[model samples]
Target chain A: MGVLKAAWWIARKDLAVEIRSRELIYTAMFFAVACLLIFAFAFVEGRTTIRNAPAGILWITIVFSGTLALGRTFERERQAETLRALLMTPVERPAIYLGKLLSLLILLGSIQVVVVPLVGLLFGAPILRAPFMLMGLLALGTTGFATVGTLFAAMLTRTSSRDVLLPVVLYPMSLPALVGGMQGTLWIFAAEPNYELVQTWLAMLVFFDAVFLTLALWTFAPVMGE
Target chain B: MKLGDRLIVVLLAVSGLMLTASPYVIDTAPYEATMGLVQRIFYYHFPMAMTMMLSAIVCGAASAWFLFRRSERADHIAVAAAEMAVVFGVLTLITGPLWARKSWGVWWVWDARITSTFIMWLVFGSYLLLRRFGGAGSEVLAAAVGFFGMVLVPFIYYSVNLWKTLHPSNSVVPSLPTSMGIPLYYCWAAFTLLFVALMSVRIRLERSRGWLERAYRAVED
Candidate 1:
C-alpha cells in the first residue's frame, strides 16, 4: 500500500509536469500528423499502393511518435536525476516501473487519440469496429514497448549518446509490438472480427513484457547503484 | 596434453581452403545447368546464415547475463559478440543475394526468410550504432537490443512450419543423406570456429583499447 502510494505520487507528478508544459502531447501529435500528410502526398502517383500501404504509414507514424515521447520523457529524468532520487525512496522497484509505465501509457495514449483520428481521416478506413478490442491491443502493445524501452532508457541515461542509442536498441526490441499492433490495427481497418488474432498477439506481447520487465527489475538496482 | 587452440585454428584454415576448392578436385554429379558452379555458393551462404543466427544468440545470452549479474565482462562479451555478428551478416546477405540472382532472375525477393533475415540484420546493426554513441556501459544498451532481436529469429526460422510457407525450404538441417550432411557439417563446424576465433581476437582488441584509454586519462589526472 505504501509502495502504491509512492507509485501514485510519481504518476501524479509526471502528469502534473505534462499538464503544466503541454509540450509532450502537442509535439508528438504534430509529428504523427505530418508523417501521414507527407506519406499521402509522396505516393500520389500510386493510389493503389497508397490504399494498401496506409497500414505501413500509420505504424511508421506511431512508432516515430512513440520514440519521440519516450526520449523526451526519459530525458526529463536524466536532466534532473529524478530516477535516481526516486530510487532513494522505499518503493518496490517494480512499483516504480509500473507507475512510470502507467504514466507513459497515459501520455502515449493521448498521443494515440489524436494520431489515430488523424490516421482514420487520412486513410479513410473503418477503424472503430470492435473499438474495445482495438483499443485494448494498442494499449497492451504500447505498454509492452514502453516497459522495455523505459528500462533501457534508465540504463542509457548515464551514457553520453543516450538519445541515439535509446531508439536504435529500443525500436528493434519492440518488433513484436510493431507486428502485433500493426496486425491488430489492420484488422480494425478491415472491419472484420479478428478477435482471435488480437488475443494471440496480445498474449505474445504479455509474454514479452513479463520477461523483459523482470529483467529490468533485476538490473535496476545495479544499474543505478549507490 | 590437449592440442592448443591454435592447432584447431590451423585445422580450420586448412578446411576452409579445401572447401573453397572442392568442386575442382571432386567429380560429383554435375549440378543442373541453371545452378552450375555458382551453386557452390550454397555451402558458404547457408553456413554464414547459420553463423549470423548463432552470433545473435550469443549476444542474447550474454545480454541476459549482463542484466543478471551486471558484470562489465559480460557486457563486454555481449558487445564483442554483436560486433563479430556483422561480418557473418554481411557475408550471408551478399552471398544469399548472389545465389538468388543466379537461382532466380532477380537479385532480391520479398520472401519471408529473406525479409526476416534482413530485419534481424537491421535490428542488430542499429543496436550496434546505438552502442557506439551510447557512451560508457553501452553493453547494457546493446544487450537490450540483442535480446529483443533474438526474439524474432526463431519466428523467422520456423515461419514456414507455422504458415504454409513459400520460401526456399531449409535443406541443410538434419534428415539429409551422409554425403551432403557430412560436408555441410564439416563446413558448418569450420565456419563456427572461424567465428569464435574472430570474436576472441576482437574482444582482446577492445579490452586493450579500453585499457589504453583509461591509462591515458589517469596520466592526465
Candidate 2:
C-alpha cells in the first residue's frame, strides 16, 4: 500500500476499534467534564468571573484530559503488542506517526464536542459568538498537542513509568499552544471581543502547529527505533 | 589533584569571593532613580537568568549532538548542563520574585518573562525527572525534551513583546548607567565562569559514575 493509504488504514483501524470499544472517548469526555466542573467550583466567585475566566479553565481542562487520552491510546498499542506488529509492517515511520496523530485529533475533537458546549453552558461564556474562530483555535491547538503527545507517548511506551513521564514531557513542550489557545479564547469571550488580539493569537497557534508537527514527524523515526 | 583541577578550584574560589563582594559593589553604585537599593538584586538576578538560558542552549546543543552521534560524552554534557540549568533556574526563580516583590509590588505575576522562565525551569526539571525515573531510553527522551525546550526559547523571549506584559523589555539593559552597567558586567563574568566551572565538575562526576556502573556490571557478570 501507498504511504497515504497506509496512514489512512491505520487511522481507520484505530477509529474502528474506538467505535467498537468506546472506552477512550467515554473516559476522556467524563474526565474533561469533571475537570470543567471542578474549575467552575473552585474559581466561580460570581457569574462575572465564570463568564470572563473560562478561557484558562477551558484550556487547562483540555490539557489535563488530553494527557489521559494520549496515554491510554498508546497503552492500548503497548498492551496488545500491536505497536510492534504495526512496526513490523512495511509502513513508513512518518505514515505511522501521521496515522496516530489523526486518531488522537479525532479523539480530542470528540471530547471538545461535549466539553466546549458544556463550558459555555456552565460558565455562561459567549463562546458561540465566534464559533468559527473558536473551532479554528481548537483545531490548531489540539493538532500541536496530539502531534507532540503521540511521539512522546510512543517513545515512553517501553518505560515502566510512562504515565508520569508523558505529561512531564508533553506539558512543557505544549506551552505555546496552551498560551495561544487560552489567550485567543479569552479575547473571543470578552465583552467586546478583540478581533485583532484573537487573530494574532490564532496566527501564533498556526505557527506552533506547523513547526511542532514537522519536528515531530522528523524525530518520530529515531525516537521509535529500537 | 591535577594542575587543571587545582586551577578550576582557584577560579571557583575567586568567583565566589567576587560574587560575595558584589552586594557591596552594587551598593557603591549610584542608586537608581526608580528602583533604589532593592535593585541590587539585579546584579545576581540578571546573571542567573543569563546563566540559566546559556545552560539551556548548551544542554540543547549537547542533546542534539547525542541524538545525531549517539556519543556517551554528549549525553554526559547534556545531563550536566541540564543539572546546572536547574540549579541556576531555581536561583533565578527565587531572585526574580524577590526583585518583583520590590519593583512590581507583587511577589509573583504571570507576565511574559516570568511565566516563560518558570516554564523553562519546569521543562529542564522534567528533563532531570525523566532521567531519574524513566526506565530505559530515558537519555534519548530527555534529549528530545531538551531540543524542544531550546526551540521554545525564542518564543518565550518574544512572548513579552507579543503580549502586553508588565515585565520590563530589553530597553532596560542599554539604558543602564555606567556605574550600574560596570557592576552588572562584572557579575555576569563571575557567574559565567562559575557556571563553566560547576558544569565541568558535574560532567566529571557523571563520567566517574558511568565508569563505576560499568565496572560494577562487569564484576557482577
Best by DockQ: 2
Q: Write model 2 residue lDDT over B41-144, tens digit each, in one string.
A: 88888899999999999999998888767899999999999998999999999998888777767788766677788889999998899899997788998888
Q: Per-residue lDDT for A144-174 in model 1, tens only?
A: 7787777777667778877777777776566
> Which regions of candidate 2 are displaced past 4 Å?
A45-49, B159-161, B165-180
lDDT of 1: 0.70
Candidate 2 local lDDT, A1-226, one digit each (tens): 7878888899999999999999999998899988987887787885645445788888888998899999998899988999899887888999998898898899899899888988888887787899999999999988888888988888888888999889988887877777778878888998778877888888888888888888888777766776
lDDT of 1 by residue, B73-151 (tens): 7776777778767778888999987877767656876565776777778777977886777666666656666765676
Where does the lowest 10-residue lDDT sum fall in candidate 2 chain A?
A46-55
Superposition TM-score, candidate 1 onto the true structure: 0.84
Give the runs in model 1 whose Cα sits over 4 Å from its true position. A1-5, A43-49, A191-203, A215-226, B1-30, B70-73, B155-181, B210-221
The native-contact fractions of the candidates, in order shown, are: 0.50, 0.60
